[model samples]
Target chain A: MEPTNERHLLEALASGDRRAAERLVDETYRQVFASLVRLTGGDTEAAADLTQETYRKAWKSLPSFRRRSQLTTWLYRIAYNTFLNSIRRPVLLQPIDEQQAVAIEDPDPDQAAKLQQRDVAERLRRAVIGLPEPLRFTISARFWGELAVEEIARQEQVTGAAIRKRLKLATSRLREALGEDAI
Target chain B: MTQPTDREVKSLLTEVEIPEPPADLAARIKSEIPADLSSGRFEGTDLEVFDAPRRSPSRGWLIAASLVVAVGGGLIALRQMDQFQTPAGALESGVVASEAAASDAVAPESVQYRSPVDQSLDDAELETVLVEEIQLNEPLETRSSMEAKPDDSRLQEKSTPGPDVTSADKVVVDEVTAGQAELDEVSADRDRSDRTRVDQKTVASQDLPSPATRKVERSEPAPSRGPQPKLETPSEQPQPEAPGEQQTRARQRADSTGAFEKRQAAQPPQAPATVESTAVAAPAPVRESARLEDGAADRSFAGARAGSALAGSALADSALAGSVLAGSYQQVRSALSEGRWPAPEAIRRAEIVLGFGFGGPEAESKQESASPADRFTILVDELVEILERRQATESELEHLLRRSRALATELDGQPAVEELVVWIEQIGALVESAEER
Candidate 1:
């Protein structure tokens, strides 16, 4: 994703270079897949298929891409749209209950002490799945995709300030749902 | 109300584990790249697998064009049929007049009379020789002439004008009348055959006398070889119908047959043998009168030939009229050559060739002023000139031949012009037979 390499790849892709398309796919497919898996609530198979589709769409739309943002950002935009389109039903978040919030906040000392009560990672996964779309997407791309805030803003077609405010709101909601003890 | 620090949230979000993507995912996507690019770099699922082949737009257009052509052709044929209808009687008369005109054109000169041959020999020998010659050279004519007596008996029943005959006789008469009507229906077709038979009879009669006289005259002793006597010896008598007696009977028989033939000419042109056989028995006078009728038949036939030739020329001259279709000419030629010429078919063909079809634009422009015979003469003269010029195409010549064929058909059953019909047919046969060569 260096400025020089991206510019060269973008130009080569615009000129219909297959190698550049392959190179772009290779550089971005993993991050896109990982982000989609989390975005799709642990649906790894669907996430993998959507990841391939995203690359294909990117290859076709590459010629029209102006390169105003990073290639990865453009790719993530395609991946997000691709996953959203492929899913048959709405991927809405369920409402959090007060007792579930209390379990994350002050885990019952007995429950916490139980030998094989669900681990912190499992609870965190459940908490992330319950987040709404776009907030879910933003949080996943930032943490799982490891994309910069500014990069996420560019990929999502939003201002950097709006992304930051969304990130703040998403974090507060997750905290309320999971409780301080879980963090 | 303060939000958690970005570092704290980022740290917590990092704890959220995401499952690893399949290792072969990118490899699978790459494998599909060539197929996608091959189909113009299409993205997403292949929809063509689900779709059936669509009908070509051009196929629909071709079907529409064929329908249009079929409908258009049907309309044109219907329109043509409407324009072509005509009453049959006027057409028949016009055709008859044209054929008679043609016969007159063929034999313009009247037959010349010659002095009677010498009468020195045996009557039995002369009759035997003439009969034998007729049987050999003019079998059909001889047959017809021989059959004429029975036919006459049959005709008597039909034309008897009395109810005294039995009911069965009346039925036979009715049948004969019906048959005659049928034959009349194709009068034009019979003319060529009748013409040929008449010509053969004329030749047989004239030539038969020659051999008989030659044999007898050669045997006689010379009387100083000076101018021979017109009279034969008294003991070497011919028939008891000596000069006036036999001549009158022969004349009367020939006259009846000849007049009967002339009347029948408007009917169908029956076989000439019927007429020829009746003349088989008569003495020199009967033979002489047969020769006179033959001469008359020849002149009529010659005129018909001239008419046919004229028709050919007229057709060539009016080739640009487009009024004469090849189909009509083919029908006329078929009728002429097919052994029977229906008067209706002959008239139809004649009008088409002569540009006289009802309401035809060409006929309107080229009014038919000359008599059919004179017009036929003009046509023959024109065709002769064209043939001499060597400027006409085979199609032009064929058109001429077809015109002659149509005229020949028109001339059928016309006993007066039987000779001309024969002549025109000879020309047609000559021209057509040349193709084999």
Candidate 2:
């Protein structure tokens, strides 16, 4: 929802409002779970556990929320940290620290194009998760939050140009890491 | 295909399917938050646990006061017991006799090591303390040995035996017993060889075993008497002290015997004399033997103290020789509990100093040490410290950890020392990075 509505929910929960607490969890659980599943590389159980943990941490830290940023961004930061602590090490998306170069050979042009696109998409997902923390956060917020570049910049207290630059750098890393797979 | 343009990557990201959460997810979350604030359980949405209010100075003061009160109360109780002991000595002795009869007495081994009973405490009081300490923290074998003054029927049953010892205890007991047996066998071998040599001298004064005869004997492969894998009855190495009582007893014995004083006194007077003698003349082999003997004695004391430290009794801690057996297992347990490991530097130093790779995989080198228990303890402490630091590339530390774990497991069932095993596994996880290797 809107930043104003989120702020209202935050206020309500902080003031001992049980209905508001339920509403907050209800609205955020799906998004948090979806975000976690992507971050965890589609491990459903880990996604669920991390989701619950994120919410539990969010609920506890709600009272301390000073509304310096959007409530969603605040919750995402908590989710990110919870994820990091649980994983204990950086998540290695590629097998054996070796990225698989896309190998394409097909007689049909259409079939080859389709296969290449599929490979590129898979590589992109892996790259997004594998991106350095700052860029990963920006990409996640932009895609999952569906927030505009300006909104992300505003929330992060950076200029719109910086957000664009981060997005550019992240895409380049993905291309480099994916190689020919980045079709 | 050429590298994908950023547009293609962006387009792909936009189309990427974000899995829909389970339907019950919202319901599950909602259920966690209480329906009403009246219960005061879910009054606030946030967790106060992690963000607990800062400790006020008052709390610190309160803790200090409580400690002081506890110490004072203990002193008062001790004094009162002392007062009562003198007037009711006869009655207390009668009570002690009855109490000993009520429970199965400790094994005869314990009787040999039992300390002089404090005149301040009655039999009942002493029993209460020993019983409480043993029951609370002593190992199973220790409790069994301490409490079970076996009835004649039970003794007879044990004599007839069907694995009277738990499998875990059986391995440890077997190991210690085998070690003793091996030492005895080696001594006997030397004695037999000496006797044959003497007899030969009498028979033929100049007819020594010739170079060919000696060569033949050397060529004959001796049968390997590796640590006897035989699981003997636990009766062979009787349980002496509970783990918790051992430490207390060790401290008491150290105080009584002025062990610390002896250690201090031993060094100073001999130090200047040894330096002067060694500098002026070549140090004799006798001095080396004396040094080795002293080292062995120190190890024996350390082992004994280690055993008693866990048993929580003075009775178990005084066994200078037996402690050597008890100390190895005790140190393992202590190392596990405390997460104590030797420093990385210490391990490296040992390797360099000893001239063999001390921290290498257990199978690689077979450098014999005068004190294997001390070496084992050092290795365990080092491995633990390394794992706790969570750097997986220390392959040497990893090997030591695995070896120690295997040693512990071989001596006991996995479940018997489950806690230590679990902790070790955690260390393994911490050290084993997501590196594909």
Candidate 3:
């Protein structure tokens, strides 16, 4: 959303305008849901719950929104944190390991290539999840959440240089973990 | 197999598949949301209009029940009165009996006649009949007092008995007049006391310092403890110091300790006994002021000690302005985690302080002192450097931890500080786990 329009909507939401909240949900829920889907490794149900949880949190925190970062970036940060907190719970459903499943017979080369891509994506997801503390968050937010380096830095309350450095370190770690050819 | 380049890896990350959200997801979420988003009430904001409490049917039923009981009691009493009034001769006899009972407690039981009609009456009816008889036989003075209004004109009329009035009526009038006089005296005394209290309050208010004067006093720097300067009389001293003069004096006092030490070391030391004797010889007001300054210093020292202790705990130090920024960060994180908004004031304070660093070179130049953002950045960088090296000594880690804790304490346990603390611990844990491996 445009910053001005977002600000106006935020003002309306802060004043308890229901229409503004509905409009916010309409504009952002898809992107938010998609980010959660990637973070949860294709668990659509958990992603949907987390998406709703993010909006609920966003609505509650609307009054304190300072327009420091773009509203979407702010929402993404909330979505990211929600994902982190959910993972901390003991009963969280583990992502299904598709690699170990019985292979289906494929006659076409395109079909086999698609399967290879899915495998690569799954491996990358696992490697990202395995990355420590802030690197995991940083890489996930940048790649999955699709947030800009500046936006992540603003959300993290750090310098742009620090965020870029983190991204570099996270990428190098991913490279090392996946074995360079895995990608 | 060929290794993927950084560009290819980045492209692959971007291409990771995301499932489409369910069609009913948005509708489901919105349905649960209240129509009025303003229901998420904020503290110190005049946005919410709360509805008045509704009256309950239970309270209404209680009132109705009370009315029914009272009306029923009244009807029963009235019925008893009607039975008593059936015969005038019987009523007269009852009043005489009641007067005898009241005036002569030792009246003979044989003299109290219980007729067949009276025997038919229950205990409640008999009691009601006796009460009515006593009210009829009461002295005129008692009845007059009970019926009289507080109006002065009515009391005067009652006091002036008519020519046909008996001696008993005259006695009643005199008693009523005496009672009215006592009430008037008490009301006058109350008025006097009220006026005296108000006057005392006015004087006390006048004696209190003005707001501006109190502000000045609060802003004033602590006095020095070196050799006492010669005291100045009210006439000799300037009436009121200018803002510049106040600032200069404060600055001088702040720098005085270093200057005093330098002077002491350069020159021969004076006898402590002589200095004490000179200080004691000072004027009473000057000595008192010095004593107050000493007390102020002691109190400030004690407060600092208390503040440090408080900062060491989980609770944030609200007195530190830097902590407000930290609080704002927490407010955002907590809002996400706990599903509540941050206070507007916390966000505003964070914005203002952050604007100093993030507002570009112009803002940095405008601010003469180091902004909280700068301090926060510096602390984060230092902590990160130590964590990255993973070769820090125990003492080094402790010192960094203390600095991190102090900053967090200033920010009031901002999640960033908590995150830093977590990172430090995680590094330690990783080292332990590696050793085990």
Candidate 4:
């Protein structure tokens, strides 16, 4: 969303405009849910619950929202924090057989290549989920949620260089987890 | 299988499927949010409703009344103490009492007690005590000087008081008059010397034939006698005035401008050199006593000046330190926004110390001899700390940059290492630009 439009929406929301709240939910709920989906290791139900909690907390903290960062970055931070608070144990990825069964059902001539791609992608996702906290968030926000490094940094309240270092570290770890020829 | 490259890893990560949110999710969240949606309140949680009891207005009034009583009692006790202290304190108390009595006479109902007789008796005792103290402290030489300079009407006016004046009031008046007399004498000495110089110049001009000779004589610098010129007598050479004595004389002059002018009018004019010579020869002990007073005053003045200079330097140093901190913050902010690194020098020593875990006496040597990788780690840690603390320093940044560059070369073709090297170089450029500025 454009900054000016977001600013207007924020102003409207601050004035108790219910329509503005709905509009905000419409614009950001998908990206937030997607990020949460990855963070919860493909648990759609948990992601949905966390997304609701994230928006609820956002509303409560809306008045004190300093516009130092973009609204989306702020929401991403809230979502990330919400996920961290809710889940204490390591995330468990969905079993590979389920994904394999889904891939097997696809009626395409390139089934073998697609299946191999699906396996590699699943391994990559597990490697990403296994990565350390901030690294996981940095990589997930950058690729899964499609946030810019600068935006991720803003959300993390860190410099862009730090976020980039985290990405580099996360990727290096992922490379090690999955072998050299996996790509 | 071979390890994947960074670009390949990134591509694979992006290609992973992200599950879409259920269609009802947005509608459900919107339904949960209340229509009003005002700040500090939710539909069921009203922050304004509290169980704590409200304070009563009488408690506030009681607090205010107690404060007023406490202050009033303190002032009354202070006034009572003043009545039994020094004669000046007693006199001040007496004046206040008289004023209060006069006010009470207008409002008879407010008069609490009457003690006019005791007050008058106390005033009389303080006056006698003050007179005795003044007489006991007065030097025989000063008294003799006053007797010897009978023609000095200013001294006569000061020593003798009117019949209506109390002894304590007369002493206070005498002290003020004496200070005025001293100021007048100093001014008279100054005027005489000025006249002497003018008379000498007139004599020299009359003796010289050419206008050029007169101009040349006038252009010659006068002999420096410090701030105040002293009169030289043939009987006894004039003593140099001490800095303290000069300051005191200056203070006296400032205090009695009216008295100085009155004295100047009352006294008959005489030859500048002869009159000043007689005045200087008359008092020998006075100059000695003034010199003694001046010695203490000079020491105090010097001490005060030294203290003032120290305070000024401290203020300047604090200002400089604040500017340095501000400069570091600005550099970090500008670098972050502009996609570059900040100056290394602008980084603080504390952050470097904390970042490297260099706590002991050998921390410096450890930091100096740290491996390139360790140094790079320290550098990144320091940068993060700087961002956290909103502050940065130079030597650590330089060391970090050097190590990072060396490591980047050693780990060639690594994108992360290359990026870090470029960032450090940008910081180096920023430091260089700052230095130029």
**What digit string (tens of lDDT, one per residue) describes model 4 on residues B116-235?**
211122334433432222222212224334434533454333323333234433443444345445544544444344345444543653432343343344233332212233432323
Q: Which candidate is the best by lDDT?
A: 4
Please give, for residues B122-158, the per-residue lDDT of candidate 3 as tens digits: 3344334422322122222222343233333433332
Candidate 4 regions exceeding 4 Å error are: A89-116, A180-183, B40-437
Can you write out model 2's per-residue Cα lDDT over A127-170, one digit (the tens) per residue? Answer: 77778888988887787546678777877889999999998898
Q: What TM-score do all the candidates reach, one by one?
A: 0.31, 0.33, 0.34, 0.33
Candidate 2 C-alpha lDDT tens digits along B23-121:
777776676675443233443444464344899999999999999999999998887565333422422333334323322332221111111222123
Residue ranges of candidate 2 with Cα displaced over 4 Å: A89-122, A180-183, B34-437
Regions more than 4 Å wrong, model 3:
A90-92, A95-110, A180-183, B1-3, B35-437
How far off is residue B5 in model 1, in Å? 9.4
Which runs in model 1 stand beyond 4 Å of their true positions?
A89-134, A156-158, A179-183, B1-9, B18-20, B34-40, B43-437
TM-score of chain A of each: 0.69, 0.74, 0.84, 0.75
Question: What DockQ does each candidate score versus the true complex, computed on alpha carbons?
Answer: 0.15, 0.19, 0.20, 0.33
Model 1 gets an lDDT of 0.45
Clashes of 4: 13
Model 2 chain B, TM?
0.20
Q: Against the true structure, whose DockQ is highest?
A: 4
